[model samples]
Target chain A: MDERMTDAVLATEELTVRFGGHVAVDRVTCRFRAGELTAIVGPNGAGKTTYFNLISGQIPATGGRVLLGGRDVTRLSVAARTRLGVGRAFQLTNLFPDLSVLENVRLVIQSRRGRDFDMWSMAAAHADLAEAAEAVLERVRMTDLAGRKVAALSHGDQRKLEVAMLIALDPKVYMFDEPTAGMSVDEAPVVLELIAALKAQTDRTILLVEHKMDVIARLADRIIVLHNGALAADGPPREVIASDVVQEAYMGKALEDV
Target chain B: MLKRILSGDMPQSRALGLILLAILIGLAFAPFLFPGTRSLDTAARICVFVALAASYDLLLGYAGIVSFAHTMFFGLGAYGVALASDGMGRSFGALAAGSLAGALAAAALALLVGLFSLRVRAIFFAMITLAVASAVAVLFSQLSGITGGEDGLNYRIPRALTAAARYAEEPFLGMRLTGKVLNYYLVFFGALILFLALLRVVNSPFGRVLQAIRENEFRAEAIGCRVVWHRTAATVISAVSAALAGSLYAIWLRYVGPDTVLSFEIMVDILLMVVIGGMGTMYGAAVGAALFVLAQNYLQALMGAAAEAAAGVPGLPLILDPDRWLLWLGALFILSVYFFPTGVVGRLRGR
Candidate 1:
């Protein structure tokens, strides 16, 4: 950890990835500070998820590096980065489908508790973890569904389970890639509300990748626009959302119909 | 008491408990109740196969890893005992030394194979293990000086385990108090301990992690579970268990042969046992092994009797011939699968 608390919690320096002559994230450098939500907005194929992957160690960078608290972590594996406090919620709701919701969350607690290698004791012996996991589920208003299998859960509940799992992990940085992508319109706000509650704590950094402009406006304190795999605009929500560069690059031929 | 014994993993179904209980009691007293060499041999084979199939389930059912190299580990234990006994003479010390060496070697080989292949996709792992296992089987056949080549080695066990060594001058309850009975007890108890140990493992916290990795590999990794590390550890454990089962077999038979342990057919048999018993349940191994081994030993004879009774029927004798026992075995498996899709244990528990 960096001694200077005022410093950026996470910073990427000219992070670039080229997939067979097609540059995905092109020389993008950005810094994210604590107590703020930075939303990365762009059109499809604009490298939003790709950038998240590099920062969370999902995919490696071809050029430059990712620094966590001024420490280089570009070569670390996904599990190593997760251990270093980089929590990631997938775009497609990646979770243990066969396990019950409580078990799913309990496993994360066990992993964090460093008891994943305890081969002698039964899983049910750790009653404290089950309680703690239920508390996390409580936060997401999913206590009723905790005993049910994740495979039987609706898309909305599955997304909520992902949040509960993330909470159990308690990582320093929260990286949510379109947390409500496939959720129904009625179910989207519940997850967005959970993200909002986390942001209100004002002690953790959250990086969100979303396409909904209204969502970006309401949740994002700082907005960075990506166009054609390059950073086109970076500023506070007010100025960046109105910038001519963003409108031209992202809005996609504004006023063609009008 | 049962909960503590099972490490909090209950059978979860009354029918499953009864079936498993029947299997446990049947094997425990085979010498006294059956009172025949053939029945005793059948019971001992059931025990050995139970342990072997349970070990395979640890990989296939819990860890969700497909490994063709399992029998290779089984062979290593058999050969370890056979060669050590050959050199050191027939003694319990030789058996113990061979068993330990074989288990260690199996663990080491599993670690190597897991490291090289577990990192890739599941299908690639299946392919790699298939290739490696075939290579080892062929090597056992070619290593004439050490492994006894294709004929394999028929070695000796301790004198106390042989039929000649009687425990007493008089027969006990119409049964001979011979060393063969003592040896059968050794095998039965050894298998019982192994099965219970596997039960303890599957209900443990580490076993839950294996189940997690099996259910969702990507999420397990994202959740800070070292997928490969956990998988490799499981592989090593499973391999060691299989080797121990092979040691029990060597002690009982006083023979170590490639076809007995290293052949691909044994690997397929193990797969069948795991599937028929239920992949994830340890008790399923016992059920699957007992069912398959009994069908193998007696199904043909039963078919022979049926063939004689049906001799007058057109084309019925040919179908019922003992030579076509495999055809009936295939039909039995298909019917079991159709009725008990999750294997017998899973079906019992699902209710």
Candidate 2:
């Protein structure tokens, strides 16, 4: 990883999202530094997911701006934003369950290669896409299950496949929502290792939304806490964890439990 | 590694191959089984419904957009063909013109409707399509002069085909299509071509993008897919297919009426067919259409003369009437939703 974090890959300014009468995300400004892993931690219904959604363009913000590498992208569509090098992983595994693991990655490769509209040509015939898909799967240590249908894979494997798809996009920034949501202790470490490996390979910025403090402590270079649609604290993990506001937000719950 | 293919594989390819073989055999031998004029007519009618159902499947099953106004396109095509060929005194060119007009009309409606309805999910979209369908029906009913009022338009056979038949002393080739076999084959071949074309489209990258949209529209949009454009393209393609089927219906029936064009029954039939066969599978449309047509035919046959006299069965209760087909269809729809959520093909593929 590059020692110099000189660039801001993703920056949010007064970002807010509202659903009808309820404010899901309040005005918040934050910047994700390049070559750093940042975690967005919050209690349930704290708007962490909502913030992620706004930044990723899953839902348009009611007010505020989002910038990707100094370029304003508040008006861009989700797809346009993605093409401009922003990738996201959903909290719920969003995959073509019937497709093979390799086919899943191959689809991302196809999109990246700009062959998404070639109707007459077979996707399987694209050797470069296949190679890139395979390489990403190998990076995630999922090559052995490449031919297996996504539906047949274990939850952990499916999560790995999701990460592999994000990696295939080769985005300048990756936003992950609950990356270790349903993993066993052993499985969580594997995913953490994979994320670390991704960080090592590229100077890409990462915004990880996680409930697991251990994973956050191990992976996050900086941490932000959200409580009821507002920012509770922002600092390094140790400082944020020790903050009185964050502890109150957790209702005196231990950081380990969080 | 070799064990992978034989042991625990989904067997999608094998299943698809078998289904394709079955369809090929059925299409090849349909004329032999339905040798009479009525039988051939029925087969042609089935082809139109199959195409309509397939088009519906593209939007509802594959793209996950529940639309009830698909019949609008079908009706438009039917009326367009009738107006061009019969009313306007045009010849073979009327077919192309009618299809293009219907598609453009439907595409325009889809764009307008999709703009608002696409923002809402599931039930809202369904209700919006229902509203559109109902509105169109009312509009056509009010426009009696252009739409031929309640009596509808009477479509005459093209002069060219009759002249050709007279010139050749037979129908088209030396083969006498004085029967329905020729018409059946013609429509069946058209449906087959459409089915194959759709199969190719669904398997390509373009198709993959649609599936991606279906799986997660937000994720798809984030990945650089223009959600509205992709959806609009699918809608237009589906509308064109429905219009083509409608044109075929107009040609086969040699009559166009408001009842056939504006009825909600056509929409229900298409939906039931797709659901019964399977959603998201290529063969689902054909399977659904076949099953629906056969069931209706059998039920009507069992009802016999009494049903024809009053459009209601004599021996059975009111539930067995021709209109009561919806009750049975509704029951099947519920059962399929509960027991086979993925439909027959989806369940088979699951195993």
Candidate 3:
């Protein structure tokens, strides 16, 4: 962690979640700084996704609280958190399969701009909204597929669209849970490039939970390794990957395969 | 129509809207064109149901909520006018105030139900509404002093709306512009304006979010929509529209009864209207309501005569009996589901 960058954009104070007796996420505390790319990598059942869910307000916390920009947002709904700028891309492909790509992106932009409740106005009548939607599509290189339905898009392209939606939201903190989890070998890097471009494009803080090491190594400036449900190691990527604890517990033979 | 379709995102609705517009115009001049009591009555019923079914679609088709409490709100509106006119003297002001009261009450009930039950599973939401509606129906029936019990309520409307009253100067098509004619036009014009307003609502930005929520609630919520609130608003809007339809029905019939407006059969009729016409398609409601009302009026008589004529035949008696008309309707519904799986309008639009 940089000393001058002491202001935490997202912080979990002893965040805990348990499914009955099974502790999915056990008392984890960490601070994500502004404008830095952080990766949460671990073996399967590491509770990385659960941690993301807690912060994104996808699920209620059994214990502890979540803070964003130094404000307590633990009890807020997923939508409330989203309005306050916590954007999430799900592990599964979560785009609206029935709606057009442009519509999907436009809904995100509309939600962020608080125009979703405009019942009397035509959706296409707003020029600013259309321009904003088009701008996000251009940024994610999906302007060509704007008219196409989300279900018709390729897996890689759909992933890009999800990122495009987050961009439309213009969230201050982004939480991506295994964004490239289901992609083919060729398609994985294309998604990574899109996500990687997000860092350079905006000064938003990003936290991603990824299984693959190479993708994490390429994008994450800082890495947090998890074993079971607790943080095993947290530091600069080079130092964290070099630690004996991460090597012994989670990343031992995993790094070798990559 | 072409300009509206081009300006709106819902292209398929244009055809449905035009068809409904033509039907409304034809019904408005039914006395002039097709002069008969039965034809006039059927036309008036179509107007009432078009509003009811279309409002039901706001919840069922657009918001994707299955509510069985619709006719409860409908009955409340009829009773609202009947009771207010009876007590406050037969005046148009009293009728309008009563109908407005009914609409507001129904909206409040819908909001309360939505706030509590909308958070549950979809099927549970349906079951909760059905239970509440049944309870309200029972309450209306048992309160004989206020609701007139099983006999129902019959009260005089304003003098100009009474059956004998007529326009003294200009006769419409050699016939006096009687109260029935005035009532027919009232229902016709009222249903049209409300239906068009509903079309405007479903085509707006708010309606798009409703479609989104119907498609995927989790995704909708994650995208910053207040899902429960949206569902609640849909319920209120739908309830108010159904109540208005009920008011029209009461005024046209000059009577309000449990069997006529508050029964589960009426709810079933509304459901069939949406399903057969098509869910989520605004125009389908009008088509469905018109077809169903026409069949109910004409087919019952046709089937009864056929059954009476075929009384000597062995199996024909059982099959063609007027009471077994539901069996024929069931078969037709099944065939409709099979052939026009998306619905009449949905299929017409090639969706």
Best by lDDT: 1
What is candidate 2's lDDT per residue for B23-132, written digit by digit as tens?
55765665565454555556666677878888888888778788888998888888778877765565667766766677678777877887767767778888988998
Task: List runs of model 2 lying over 4 Å from the truth.
Answer: A1-6, A16-27, A41-47, A92-100, A147-152, A210-220, A223-258, B1-33, B160-185, B302-344, B347-351
Which scores better on DockQ, 1 or 2? 1
Q: Which tens-of-lDDT digit does each residue in B39-74 have in candidate 3?
A: 888998998999899999999999999999999999
* Model 3 deviation from native, Cα RMSD in Å: 2.5
The digit string of per-residue lDDT tens for model 2 on A1-258 reads 232323678888899988899988899888887778988988789898899888888788999999988798988888888999989888898887877888888878888888887765544556888899899998878889999989999998888778778888888888888877776677666677878977776588998998777778788889988887877788988888888877776635658465
TM-score between candidate 2 and the true structure: 0.82
Ranking by DockQ: 1, 3, 2
Note the B-chain TM-score for every model. 0.98, 0.81, 0.92
Per-prediction TM-score? 0.96, 0.82, 0.94
**lDDT tens readout by residue for model 1, A1-258:** 243334888888899999998999999988888878999988899999999899988788999899898889999998888888889888888999988999999999999888888888878888988999989988888899988999999988898788778888988899888888777887788788988988998888899988777788789999988877789888898888777777776865641222
